[model samples]
Target chain A: MISRMRILDGTLLALEAEGMRPTAARAAGWRRAVAGCGIDSLETLLPPAGAGDSPDRASPVAESSSPPGNAASRRSAAPERPPSLSELIARVLPTTVVPSVSALANLASGAFPQSGWHCIYGLGDALFADRKTLARSIDSLSEGREALLAPCFTNERGCATALAVEWLLGGEDRAALVSFAGCGGLAALEEVLAALLVHGGLPAADLRGLPELTDRYRRMGGGPIPPAKAVIGEAIFSVESGIHVDGLWKSPDLYELFPPEIVGRERRIIMGKHSGKRAVLVKCGALGLPVTADLAERVLQKVKEESARRKTSLCDTDFIALYSTCRAGKDEKEEGGRAVL
Target chain B: MRFCKIVDTTLRDGEQAPGHAFSLDDKVFLASLLDGAGVYQIEAGVPAMGRDEQDAVCAVKDACKTAVVSTWNRLTEEDVRASVACHPDIIHLCLPVSERHITRKLRTTQAALLRQFSRVAEYAAGRGYRVTAGFEDASRAEVPFLLQAAETAKRHGIERIRLSDTLGMLRPSSAALLVRTAREVGLPVEMHAHNDLGMALANSAIAVLAGAGFIDTTLLGIGERAGNCGLGAFVAACREYTAISPLQARKAERLALPLLSRCRQRKFFT
Candidate 1:
């Protein structure tokens, strides 16, 4: 079902903007990851030729093969450089068997040939426009051609993700322009995919490859993803509050809309200042530790004190140590009472 | 121009986030920044946490020149008494409205819970304090019961009714419906959104569009789970729908960086 929707990802462009060299290997890896996530296309906007210090040195083609000679003398002989962007795209395009490759161009410029490139219009004040106005804009600019409306992430009007999803849900057969992890202020590929699945009735498996894609994104210098980011945050499934833990224990549907396994994640119970005795007992049970009423109470008290003192949640090691200490204390008190008896 | 009041809870709910413990100085500084950013209200803290917390709340109250200062409390006389000692501009009493929270968490029936809420709101109002009733987890509550609870708040002379999406489980459509339903009670509705689903900003924006008068926010969206709706993000997202000034938004954005730096310096996420 996701094949019916078109998604254009601009992760390579984002990487280049972050000062990472746009190598053939990085592009190929990105293509594989995007394809694995069921995305339709990969979009990149390379720097204009001759913009970098040494176009030849930065070119992936040059990196692959060069005539054996003194590099300085060769450069001095002819200071001409090939169209590196075209060469890089050509090299990377052949490897993407699933998703097609496209170039990025600004809607205002109208210079780049629109045959194989996606034109992006900046949604400035239009972000606050009603659905009718936005539809008219999309239809007028698209003009029977595929046009991708990109939101100005710096615009103080609204959220880029919400705008993109609104457009996608409202438009008919309109392609979405996004970037992995929402880099470069474009809509995030993962978040949009999750929204489509939730709102558009797309198949759940469409998002099953997120955990792997997340790993690849980080490996490709996409920076650390926020742990609480929507749909793909690593710690989104982790619960800590007393009421929430108890509710999830009673019925997961009471708290979670979808199971964590839908995104290849698992539920985690965190012990912190807000944790209660029920959480301690559940955590102890999960860890295969013996739990008594008094022990659970004492351990919870210790957890709250320690988490408050450290200003952070307790790790498994810290929880285990506290449990052991409480158990030992209980044993000591019992022994002292026996001596008195 | 339509105006949506901004209530910044960075010092209260934001500090409830795991790994985030703001000292009195941090609370005072953040409160001043939020006030400078033109927030209408600041939920300082829970005074019942002890003398230190009460002192922090008072310091934030003193530091704010424009914003109204408020304190969060449970539906109990003891909590209200503690809040009164702080002398905040408003006292907010949180009552659980959902069946799951009321019966399972609080172990009480809906009627009993409503009675308790009425008693607490009346008690706080009788003390000559402006009182607000917060319906914790109202997103999951039955619409009829939620409306009834809203009526009870209005009957008690409560100034406002806050609908808290405690679990952050609402999408835009559901959020709009909840806000619309709550607005029918003829009392001002405030939306306190959480970001567990990453839709807090979207939900808050929709709530404003759906006739809610107040929106709750925290700096950098820091709160218990994913966090509350972010002050900067919400202002940016709802600028068209709300009367929040662009200058104030820029000021809030500018202050957010230093708050982030402070959190980073303290290694809040570590």
Candidate 2:
């Protein structure tokens, strides 16, 4: 079974980044939404914070009455014990097509999550343990549920397509099956989501914001959506990274051709090589950091230095750290002197 | 050189060869084949031609993923609007840069043509389109006028400019010089050469090496008269020359060849 703690951690992180309080319902909602939308591992799903004790650098917990925000303390907290493999089998075996010998061993051993749909597309040898593993699992599944399998025949892979079609047909149980079309790769993911959201009892209008979610998925996979890609292309809202972030921020609606809520994402200011000083200053004003002409210049210089050192374009965290460092400093020398490394 | 964005205009301009025409399904099948061949851009059609052209553009736009879809437009605002209706990412606006064509075909003074084009381009830009302005017959245009047109485009914010050798009159050396001149004006250059003298591919290669970021090609080199450079042939040449890296060359061949073959196949079937 997928570790509940890991799921919780991922949900909490996505929630925190989205600026929502980490209540149980919010956590569950995020879980349900993410579970419905994708099949990536929990670690792969959330935006990475940093390597090794990178310090809880998310935007200072907004309106915090509680000490040590959820992320701050959760990082050091003990890992929650995951439900045993047998326990997971007991919970999910009832939802599969057939329950057989080897399937019991794998499910009881907790190789897969107890709940939530699993959609694996492309190269099943790498993604799934083996076809036998899938067959055994299908055999062990309970009645009234079916597992969809599409084989790749003659260079054309039908596995992903068949799974997707079954997932759509499976009805209110809401479990889904999906396979990759080999040619489309991750390209078909959005179409799958849109098709599912349209035909699978999902609120279609609510899914109008799916483009942003798909964009987030693309970013998570480290893919660049071509500037002209529909919905979430770089050129749509981005006017050369930071140079236009504030302008985009002011009229987020204008820049937002797609709604933000469908995939539980928000438009953010990304600091990069092309960010304008006015944009930085404006961002500072929003973050409650006082700004001046000299400060903006200093910030820009710091950004350039840090970005070069890190070998990445400046991100929101870098901007926040610079602002936070400036807040703690008394003079320009102290403000500018901190090592970016 | 960096990975150049190769645009095959085979289905659009290729089909425009004197005795050639592609049915809608033929166009879609050819576009799909091109999509697999790994081209970076496809100038699909001239939408202002009619509804049939617009339909071809729509079908290709809906299905293809390997390359960005673009449409060719003349320097008129009406053409730009018509092209916009089909939703191509890049609208390639063409204007005659040569004084001979400007004085005769356009029946206007050089200064008047420039002003009119500038106004039309400004409107296109205001609409937030990525405009690629092509100087039709650029190789024969007077150097100063070519420079002026390019400078005018750059000053008015055109993203890319093309130097079309209308009659394939230039050799590789002249193509290189013309491309260098365009780049000297600080605008990205795309080379569109005909093969009247069987030098389109050679000129394209030289132009690319001289800093042109884009090259236009037609399938099987089919076009008016002796046709343009064959896109598949140009891709192979770029690969052999290592003009672009192995990865991109491989990608271009994969994305462009199948569509070209499909087009040929459909022509046979029809």
Candidate 3:
């Protein structure tokens, strides 16, 4: 029944934290891409002076504007008395920006100044805690205020997204703080969105822009996206094994969770050591080549042998060459059988 | 927290990916690393492929000191006979349990498939092999049929049941429900999660939390299409839920880095 939700993407902050300074142009592209995916807002970590660019200059969707220099430097400069939340809010209010503060549950004890801002309470070690304890902790922290729970683990281990989705499903309706590709130890924005779209009644069109967004992310100096990466990997739609290819041929829904077109990808049949006759037939049909069962079997055998020897799937050129050889062999066999008769 | 067994399938299912073909040496080396990292079992390879694959499985079994070596097989006597030649500690039989896989892919009815599985399970069990049933495409299966398959496994002395999310279609809630329901049959459930929708790791962890006894993993999540759950990431993710030692998890992560780097340098992933 939860309807109202917001997604705060932290891809820009994640890039900066990884020591890659994204240009204003790249930032603008990133913003446009995410906006197309229906993201509510973008979160950027304000870099120090002369950091080469500013997200405010890049896009108007960025909601927070903090003082220059990282959080660590600011905290170290006034170690004797750290700036309170109210003091930081006062500084951010002059710029007409509602400050967004991220803090752990332990540090988020006191309350004050009901200003128009959101506080992201980090789940920290409580993410590893048992379900009951974790739920109690979440309820206690966001009991009376507009607090968004942030599932921040140390790495992109599996739990952050699951924790975020669980909170979104079972906990109260609230904004979720996530990062693209799960950078900066936050829940992955793509995964959370996909989950909501598929299981939580969100629009399927919300994810059609993931492929372009991923490409833009790579151009922004993000690390190489693993081909097997969930939601956005290029190779995810490629089918190789016999059972999978057969299942997909019968019905894509049988073997696929969602259609590839939903994420702007196409289904591909790859010829490999595990390729079956059905896969070869499907590939041939897609290539606009007509073939009988006999030809398909011969071509399939050759495809398997060559793929096993090469230790990789065959390209279309390789398959076409193998098909020609098999066709010639079949023709010779037919001529011999006719002569014998 | 319950201790979930780690079943490293890097040499078997991980090799099924298009670009990966591990040599005999690579198999043994990876098996040794997994053993040193305290993995509960290693699914070495499918023996029905030929002598080279059998030799690789045998080599891995000989190289590992603590981890048990297992072989993957289809539900048939021929596949079981091939696995027996490798002398693996466990024989895993993969069964397609979903209606689509049962009627369409397998071209058989549910009862017939289960009958085939029963005959094969009895054969493997009679050979003094520890048999495990892998319900392939179990996520799309009906709950009652899945439980029936689990019951059949238990009846035939099958050691464990592997619930495979073959299409990586499960969310955490569904994964937890599947694991809990399977646990009701009084058999240890192992999760074989795929990452097509990018929820493999999350589903695997949630399965563990929901009473699954084992989780399957690959070195860098390499497998068919998107891949299976990653070994290093899964260990790191389930640290609080499972009794895996932190030191052992660190060792696995450290070994995995160089191995992954080597694979990357060799252009295995393209």
- How do the candidates score on chain B by TM-score? 0.94, 0.88, 0.94
Docking class of 1: acceptable
Write down the C-alpha DockQ for each prediction. 0.31, 0.02, 0.46
Model 3 alpha-carbon miss at residue A13, Å: 2.6
Cα lDDT of model 3 by residue, A193-281, tens digit:
77777676455346788888888888888888777777887666777777678888887877787898888788878787777889989
lDDT of 1 by residue, A177-296 (tens): 566777755567776667666665345335677888888777777888876677787656777767578877877766665677877778888887667788999999999999899889
lDDT-superior candidate, 1 or 3: 3
Q: Give the TM-score of each candidate.
A: 0.77, 0.41, 0.84
The global C-alpha lDDT for each of the candidates, from Candidate 1 onward, is 0.69, 0.53, 0.72
Candidate 3, superposed: residue stretches over 4 Å from native? A19-21, A38-117, A124-127, A146-156, A332-341, B50-52, B240-270
Error of 3 at B165 (Å): 1.8
Sliding window of 10 residues with minimal summed lDDT for model 2 chain B = B261-270
What RMSD value applies to candidate 2?
22.7
- Cα error, residue A151 of model 1, in Å, equals 8.1
- Model 3 lDDT per residue over B76-191, tens place: 89999999999999999999889988887778999999999999999999999999999998888999999999999999999899999988778778898999988999999999
Q: What value of lDDT does candidate 3 attain over all alpha carbons?
A: 0.72
